[model samples]
Target: MNTHFSLFRLPETFELDNQILEQRYRTLAAQFHPDKFAAASGFEQKQAVMMTATLNEAHRVLRDVIERAAYLLKLNNIDADSPEHTHFEPEFLMQQMAWRETLMDAKLENNAAALTELAQTINQAQTELHRNLQVAFSENHLEKAAELVRQGRFLQKLQQEIHAV
Candidate 1:
């Protein structure tokens, strides 16, 4: 599979070194910079632009835990974001409801402190899911990984809601 990890010459795993990724991204960005291809033929310039876009998207997906998990699921022939496959565990569904209620209450009360606390809680949950996702992928548990990806997406959306608050 020609994944972002492949593009960076790295193994396809959840564990990645941020520093190394940053350095590689910079190096690749420089080489693919559209300006570098300006003096080239029209076809070459177009190809450079397309590669640059792909590089940028790869960098973004590889850098974000949630996005990376989803991408990996896709690589495994699973679409984690598919609406028809929305089957979250009951416990998680209950927690999601509670979190939403808490967010709603905080918004109504204009409680910035509560919102901040909620964001931290969601971040911690995201971290745990990230860890679990790594383990799932390592064990070749694609189904579990897909579930975690969907859960992470929920928490990510909650985080965005908190930010909007």
Candidate 2:
């Protein structure tokens, strides 16, 4: 499979300029739009459809940090997505429990304000994870990057729960 970064002519890195990715995605989408190939042979139209879908998927993966991190891990032959199989550090695991307790407590108390504040704190933690992932990737520390990717995933899910509350 062609890498997502190569589709957008980007380097495989944790940090990307999302604005530029969106612009390039638009250009690629327009170029491969099925309408543009409507008058062409059936094969050509099919090709256009496939290309458009690929571009859409690539854009979706590249624009999100968590997805991008997973993609990077995949490229390195690492699996970070399966919570049941891939174990996180004990400290992080303990912290995850604490975060969940805090979130549950806020919900039990019916404190939207506390939930919102907790969400903000989780967002900050996610930002830090992203930053650390960049350093890990830059140093070719794929294992560390994969661990951070898992942490980010947990934080993202926790934040979603907070918002749901």
Candidate 3:
């Protein structure tokens, strides 16, 4: 895997400075943009295109908290993307189901206030999970980090569902 942190000259951590990331992205983008090599040889242009694509992908993965965490896990030989790697605790699973039911109920009743409140609640949970994830990473607790990532993914999906409704 290409190290996105290396590409952006950033540290390999969930906590990042968005301002510095944006600046690095823009600098690399301008340097690797295909248009800059439009008059160059065909091979040079193709290389530029590939580099530009890589830069964009690296920037995207590093900018998002979830993706960045997953990438870090991957670097540590953890298969975070695999289904078998995700094993949420029973309590968390039950809570997820209850949240889903609440979402469904709010939708059926056309309750905008309820949906808004649910979104807020989920967002708070997501924030807390992120904090836990940071500690997990710092402590070298890959299993705990992976579990937090799974919960974070659930909350993210729930947030999207709330938005769709």
- The candidate scoring highest on lDDT is 1
* lDDT for residue 76 in candidate 1, whole number 0-100: 76
Model 2 TM-score (2 dp):
0.90
Quality of model 1 by C-alpha lDDT: 0.91
lDDT of 3 by residue, 117-142 (tens): 99999999988988998899989999
TM-score of every candidate relative to the true structure? 0.95, 0.90, 0.94
Scored by CA lDDT, what does every candidate get?
0.91, 0.89, 0.89
- lDDT per residue for candidate 1 within 1-165, as digits (tens), equals 588999988788878898888899999999989999999999999998999999999999999998988888788789999988889899999999999999999999999999999999999998899889989988999999999988998999999999997
| Clash pairs (backbone) in predicted model 1 | none
For candidate 3, the 10 contiguous residues with the lowest summed lDDT are 79-88
As a whole number from 0 to 100, the lDDT of residue 40 in candidate 2 is 100
Task: Count backbone clashes in candidate 1.
Answer: 0
The positional error of residue 102 in candidate 2, measured at the CA in angstroms, is 1.8
Candidate 3: segments with Cα more than 4 A from true spot: none
